[model samples]
Target: MKASVTDKLKILADAAKYDVSCASSGSKRNNKNKGLGNATGMGICHSYTEDGRCVSLLKILLTNHCIYDCAYCVSRKSNDIKRVAFTVEEVVDLTINFYRRNYIEGLFLSSGIFKNADYTNERLIRIAKKLRNEHNFNGYIHLKIIPGASPEVMREAGVYADRLSVNLEIPSERSLQKIAPEKDHKSVYTPMNWLKEQIAENREDSRKFRKTPMFAPGGQSTQMVVGATPETDHHILNLSASLYKEQLLKRVYYSGYIPISEDERLPALKQAPLIRENRLYQADWLYRFYGFEVNEIIDETQPNLDLEIDPKLGYALRHLDQFPVDVNRAPYEMILRVPGIGVKTAQLIVKSRKYGRVRYEDIKKMGAAMNRAKYFIEISGRPLPAASAVPERIRHEIIYPAKKAQLTLF
Candidate 1:
């Protein structure tokens, strides 16, 4: 007997959990009242199927048969996992039905590489094209741009997708070969470059056409698998930094590599390290928005981030001679690098300090993280946590590694 639509949704959504880009909060677009579009910043919540995972969209694979036997993927051909594919109409019906019932915001459609990259991407694009042009359904569509897919297909996919992504899958090409061997690094990055170009071109067109059509209004993003290989935190952040700088990516998601594929080449971790992924993200943030370079954030001297200390504090300690920034007198750039002060707090400090000298107590009012900030800031006539009187022993107690050797200059 054939399973019902809910049965397929259960299997597919469980499979889709491996993808990290499904968090539906980053971009916002709305649904038309009578039509099938709705993106309220929050994607649909109550469409829970058999799995306890939140139902954001009708997430599913276009096909499960793959050409690549990536050693780290459950969908690898060598793995004996159950396989399934939704016919284009079946997917269309499932999405339309799910939307009508208010189950999903849009479709996050991906696939295991079947036949070829172009063939796989074509099927994925067909779903988006049908959703937009044929059905006029315009919720959030996040389509995967299968690496090695032709530029023309990428252009078509971009036209319909709210966002497009090509998973980097592994941190280094060396690891990629060790695991996802059939996958090409050029294939992955080339399409990323293509989508970025298309988005830029589309943005330019919209600027001139005013009422011109929108192409991927949400922008492009990619994923990097963490701990799957011997790649360090520094290595991961460096790759992300390069992606952000050159590819003009919106976000780079980090997934802790789960040993879903039972390849002997893969690590047998007790559990995936979410903390490692989190630290990479923090480092990536510092690189992108915080105006820190990859070299400054992590380097040959310290090839990996201190697992215990936040990167901001780590930087401050390494560059200790620059510390004790005067809250009332320091420049904004100097204030921002303080261990406990974020960009927001730094802005607030500068803004309020202009009128009158800000006090230590007032610093916390602006949302500075007092515990770490207190060690580095002095405000008004009152010093923070009495920085002026803080003995060297106290500062040493807080910093990392407890090295008895003398601290060297940067």
Candidate 2:
């Protein structure tokens, strides 16, 4: 007898738990054609792990079999692990059932290369097409773009998927070769470049048609496994910056490396760098909404992010030339540059400033974390006395005990 759908669900869902690119924000579901599902602007409510972290979607792998032995991957061909692959029907049924139960808002599908890259990508697209065209499912769908997949298949996948991702697992090309000899940077980036161009052209066509067939409205994103390769956070962020600026990605996920397989080819990190990953995410936020460039957050000397201070704080410390920003007088963008301030706090500054000049006390009342913000920001022409009086001393006092050399995001 064949494995039941429940068995497939356990295997595929377990395999997919490690993937973190399932945010459902980029596309809206159109159920005009009696479609079975739809992507709303509000996206879907998050699903959480047993530990209480958000799981969001019913993430799953179509197959665990692999032809390549990537050093860091547990599913490497050489590893002695139970393997499985789902037929297209199995995946489609699983997604619809999960969605009906409210178990997940959608599906995020990926696979280990089966037979060849295009073949794997073709299967992925078939699953989406079956859902969209046959099943008339309108729920959010995210598909992994297999490296070296043909542009035609990539386009098809784009039309079916709300979001697409191609993971750049390591920061540097040299490390990619070292860890996964069968793969190269070119293979990884080829589909990515194609997706970017397709999205641009599709959007332009939408301008003319008012509604060109939806093609990855949520946009494309990629991931990098931190700490597995020699490339520093600076290198990682620079690459991310390029991907965001050039490729126009919606997000870049930073994964901390967990040594799941024994390969001398990989590094010997004691544990995954979750804190470092958190800091990098914070830095990524700065790059997107805070008007920060790669040069501003990292450079040759500071290749790695400061594990103690978050990226916002670290950037403020290094560039005191721009500090003591007046929250009341400075623009909302400048307020976002402060060490401890986030997008929420920055918005509050804008709101309060319009009514009347905001005082230092008004900032605290507006929900600013004043202790950290005070060091890097001023209000109504008065710099925080302690931050200005002893900036470096205060910086060290705040961050010294918290620094860690190794960072990861597992």
Q: TM-scores across all candidates?
A: 0.86, 0.93
In Å, residue 52's CA in model 2 sits off its true spot by: 5.1
Off by over 4 Å in 2: 400-410
Query: Best TM-score goes to which candidate?
Result: 2
In the range 265-307, model 2's lDDT, one tens digit per residue, is 8777888888988889988988888899888888889788888
**Residues 1-410, model 1: lDDT tens digits:** 67565676666666776777765555566555566676666555655545344667667887677888888776788878667777788888888887887767778899988889888999999988898777878688889888888988888887788888888989888889887778879989888888888888988998888877777777888998888799888788888888988999888998888767657989988788877777787888788778888888899777888777778777776776676888888889889888788998899889988899888778888888776788777665445553534335435646532453445432
RMSD each, Å:
5.2, 4.7
Weakest 10 consecutive residues of candidate 1 by summed lDDT: 401-410
Q: Worst lDDT window (10 residues) for model 2?
A: 401-410
The global C-alpha lDDT for each of the candidates, from Candidate 1 onward, is 0.79, 0.82
